[model samples]
Target: MQEDSPLTEATSDSRGASLLTSREPSPSDHSGRGTSRRSKITRKSHRKSRAGCVNCKSRRIKCDEGKPSCANCKRRQVRCEYPANPATSAAASGLVDPREPGDLPISEIELTYHWATTTCHSFSAWPAGVARVQALTEEVAMKNQHVLHLIFAFTALHLAVCRPKRKEHYTTTADYHYERALALVTPEIASLSPDNCDAVLQSVQMICFVSWARGPQAGEYLAFGKHGRSDWLVMFRGIRTTLASLSRDHFSKTHGPNTRGKGRLLPPSDGPFEYEKQLMELKEHIEFVSEPADRDDNVNSVEVLQEMYSNRYGGKDGEYHVAFGWLYRMSEDFLDRLQRCDPLPLIIYAHFVVLMHDLEKFWYMKGWTHHVMSGIYEALPIEHKAYISWPMARVGWIAP
Candidate 1:
């Protein structure tokens, strides 16, 4: 509830009496009347204090006594404090720090709540609401929690797109939540091997998104206590290790073929082995393309990359089409350059070049890529020739 102002009421009365007081008063009397009116107005104006959440009030150096906590406290994930008699308590406890006039007073409780509510509160709230609906077992409750954790982790992943600096804190929270989520999901996985299914898929996706969104964090987390990009590389390397483990137990049940009661299926002799080899090829190619390069390759040049991007593969018909279908759009030459370029440096440089409009320097150093590719196009097979040239011809119009 808002407090009424004593000064406002007193001011109205003073205004009403102004005409009477002005009627031929003695000079001394007039001065005394003026002083009295001023003092009364000051006291009325100063009466009753403003209250806010401890966090907000401390930040504002005002009393906060509203909804257990103030808006700022809630937003910042800080603790909120509500003293019994806020005004009296503030004065007695010297809550107001004179030295740092700008400092806000936020209680620990308010901060914690602020962080929870602002960040993962919505996600965490889901498990609680879900647990009560169907008499959930501890295992089931944990699974629900896992879903909530995935939700929170992805939420953090999305946030990383905009708030890159907060990646570390968000990552920490996400992984801790992930472990709990994994505990819930693992039993289901163990029981139903390959059919480990949706919950597992989501958890894996969350891990992938988190790693992709904040690559640096993946590096740090996987390293135990070690530092650097090798750990980051492990993000992919580790995928293989995981697959190796999965293959040992669940490969046959989940995949085609039943080797039950037969001889053991060795790595290279099995179909799954071949599939894994193909997967590894793709993984290796990705790692290679994304690796750092000291100089610009043909793929890195804007004109050549743009040509590669504009080219599309046709289906069975001999129509105008580019290969790899629509899904592989980024798989084009320009993207290849990005894939080949050291993502860390290239992304930063791209941002700078974009911000500064350094197209002149960009083209000057890389423009000849088109000329080089023109010769390579001539050597292509007849079918490939048409696809390459048409896209190349249109490159002038499609300025990068």
Candidate 2:
């Protein structure tokens, strides 16, 4: 190679200087000035953040330190909690006293007991298995985060619905615990273990209750609107899928020895139950009525009304399928009318509430039937009162 070019020589010298600076300071270079300058530059380049909300800190992002909520969390719509300052923050927020029992907060314990006694009994629809909810509540709920959060969420929702004066406070508390349980349990939904299976199933059930509790008119109507109906269906489907997974796993474990070495086994199919047949009929009726040319408003309306009662007491599985099924099967125009609290739709909905009474085995539906019926009664006009007489009689409401 020819004599090194000035540019190449300069590059090599700079690389050597970079290498020297990266290494620990050597005694030969220790005027202390070079080391101090390098350290200062390094510190400036890799400064550690000393203040920010916990969410921003955990995410390793810069925070604008907004009060109540930081900019980062506001953008993401996540809870922004700051690190507790022993001096000022704790006192301002009315932090729980350290002397209070730490095992379970007194308020939480009270809510759990309330759920066990009142809420548990209300949702247990099956007569023979009613005690199971109470057993699970007492045995597993206290120690399990998923179940505990569900209990708190349910209790708060119940209070919110039953005690309107304190609805906001109870709703806020319910949302907090619901979010916590959802965050913890969502990841494990796909890979449920035997240890967590029961909690997951129970959480699904409680989540269903939460959905119902927050439903249209505070769990009164079938929540037929687009926003409420789709969300409720999603949660209902989640419960169905989770239950199916649990059943499949249990079957696999039970038959594993006999089926050893068998390639991945498929789940055994149980044919549709009786209620499913009625559901199919209802769907067929809806399809017929929805046809452009074949649609007869008078005939279609009559057919739908009849089907509502045909599946009113939803075969053996309980009334939820039929109760919600009717709401789901209705045409968009009908649903819109229902959402607007129209008299005819309210009358129809009140009949569905009659079906709900038979589902009282479910705690969430205990007072719902009466509450919805009362709302219909209040909203129905005098001229339209005659139209709802049959439904009123069915729900045991004597018209004034």
Candidate 3:
């Protein structure tokens, strides 16, 4: 036989090498098999957790499985609700069935009603007025989304303010509902209509209280304070203007030359009433107090001092008239100066707190006088502390 060619010899060598390689596993082959095995093991070990509370489960976190409230939600101070079994949760909780036609979920309706009766009471300066507003709001909220959202927003804000442990949760809920109310009412701000006027007014009032709750305290002035009283004053003016417009429109429609003013639609305007006269007296007192001693020829004028005393505390009209009267007559410039932390305005504000003491019978104004007075004391300079002394004394605070 002829000697094998070089090409035939090489081919035979390649076939032998391929057979040897197939017999022994390479590094890459071992790595691929190891990875596949690990993946299968991981898949087998992973299981969905059904034992956790709804909040933890939804967040894909491990739950401590505490009863009623899980550790995760308890730590966060959020509502710890479990997933209700379709057959039993509603009945167990005493909740109305949500499937009924024309009926809202019981929780929502109950919350809204609670807010109207209980939470709203805290914001009203007058119980009778709040009762009437609550009745009207309940009647209107069913038909108007704007009113409904405002009620929820007020409820959430009240909870946020009153419940310190759950403040974050309630604040978030308040903001969500407030935004919803704002979105619905923004379009109607410019266009006033009889149909939406009541809802709009109620919403504005609730929003003002919400703003008050969120406004900066004395401790927060250096860091978190915004425009302070300037923003509140602007809202106050806006509310007044809106009410005036509503009153005018209502008057024109209901009263005519031939008809008596029998049916009034809007509530009576919040007037200074007798407080108007008291305001004039206060203006005079302020002038007297601010007057220089040298300018007065009668340095020991008993009559002037006596009149000042009478007006200062609203002698016969009572302190409420004097305090609220000053508030009613306070100028925009005064509010602006207050926001700027002007010493004089702060001193005046402190004095006003004395009047607030008498008005604390209103749930909304309770503790406010003390809070504002304390804030002023903390914020003022040492030299300016004397200016607040009389007011502080009036409010039963002793200087330290």
Candidate 4:
């Protein structure tokens, strides 16, 4: 489980470095759930393929390619079947042949490889003490947080790269990072923060949204597996419940006003004033444009205002559409930066964008009982397709 052990492998190191071991106990250990953890494990089943189940691949252990019966499956005693359909089987092959239409460019793939190797090096550089701490806690040390951050951020970077390029499958390494991040944000970590309420809220919203995007009912963006179908809806509803808790009073006294007459200041409770202003500006912009102008020169405040309330209160009939015009644009900007320059913060921002995008989608879909994304999706121009694609691509069982 050491950082040097590699992600594809799934074996315990005697050195006491276990990155991601199953501490929750395999499903067989408990009979309450319908499925066991062994069945839930994501593994490839092609006999000739070397990149097998993450556990076997990492340990360099032999994989039987047995559906419900691989070596790992037998060891863990779980089902190990491969995808049933041709399209899915091809995807499970995990071979990125450049000849494939949607395969990443050689340069991009090389960059990805380089980044991954660099991340591994960084992970390895941690003091043995930190590794020991992480092993005991089953979580990476603060030194390892940067690696996780980069992993989350890279999703937006890939989105930006995918914007101009229309490939059969527009998903990227970022999605995988996001999924892992969600998996990492356990209840243990969340309970550690009591003062950082907003941070916790934001994190919860982000995970919920990401889960929804990759859940069932994701339509065209269903890149993950079938589990997304049930998960998407469940997460969508959960997002509403979480966000609904955010009544006007939910704003911190510092962010909102003590009295009605006093102006509400947003920066203190959130991150910064500039971000709040930028968010407000985007909200205003979305309100302004969501209408039909009688004259191009005239400002149709009435139409715009109506659209605003309608969107906020849920379209015409309690149907909510998350306002993510700003979130979408910001993600696109970060992505563009990554493609044109170093892919660090830009990648990180992409994860931020994905998290926000999920929040917006969850607010509207499960909360409102309508396809709120349609309005948001339709509101944008063709130029914004890539921004939409980032989240849309997550609309599968288990978005990569």
lDDT of 4 by residue, 1-400 (tens): 3555333244455432322221111111111223234566955433542534444564566765543236774565322333234444343353322123442233233333443333222222133423432232223221243233333334233333335352212233345345445655555234533333333334444454444433334332211112222333233433344434556366444322222122122121221223333334434543454334222211232233234333433323221223332222223233233333222222222223332332332221232212323423443445543443433433211212
By lDDT, rank the candidates, best first: 2, 3, 4, 1
Summing lDDT over every window of 10 consecutive residues in candidate 4, give the lowest-scoring window: 22-31
**Winning candidate number (lDDT):** 2
Q: Order the candidates by TM-score, highest first — what do you get?
A: 3, 2, 4, 1
Please identify which of the two predictions, 1 or 4, would achieve the higher lDDT against the true structure.
4
Runs of candidate 4 exceeding 4 Å displacement: 1-172, 188-196, 208-307, 310-400
How many steric clashes between backbone atoms does each model show?
33, 6, 0, 25
Q: Each candidate's root-mean-square deviation in Å?
A: 22.7, 19.9, 24.8, 18.9
User: Against the true structure, whose TM-score is highest?
Assistant: 3
Q: What's the TM-score of each model vs. the native?
A: 0.26, 0.47, 0.53, 0.27
Candidate 2 residue-wise lDDT, 151-250, digit = tens: 6788887877677886776776688678878887787676787667666766776787776666445433443432344455456556556655655545
Candidate 3 lDDT tens digits, 1-400? 0123111122244322111111111111001112224644553233234655656887898766554456787787654444545423444344543232442233344445457447756633345445544555554555556666666766776666577787788776666566767888888777877666666666665666565556435443211124354444555456556666765455223221122212222233232234345435544544566436322322222223234334544334322323343544455555555666655556656655655666555443546566667777876788888766766766777655
**Best of the two (1, 4) by TM-score:** 4
- lDDT-superior candidate, 1 or 2: 2
Better of 3 and 4 by TM-score: 3
Which parts of model 1 have CA positions greater than 4 angstroms off? 1-75, 78-144, 160-202, 215-235, 244-400
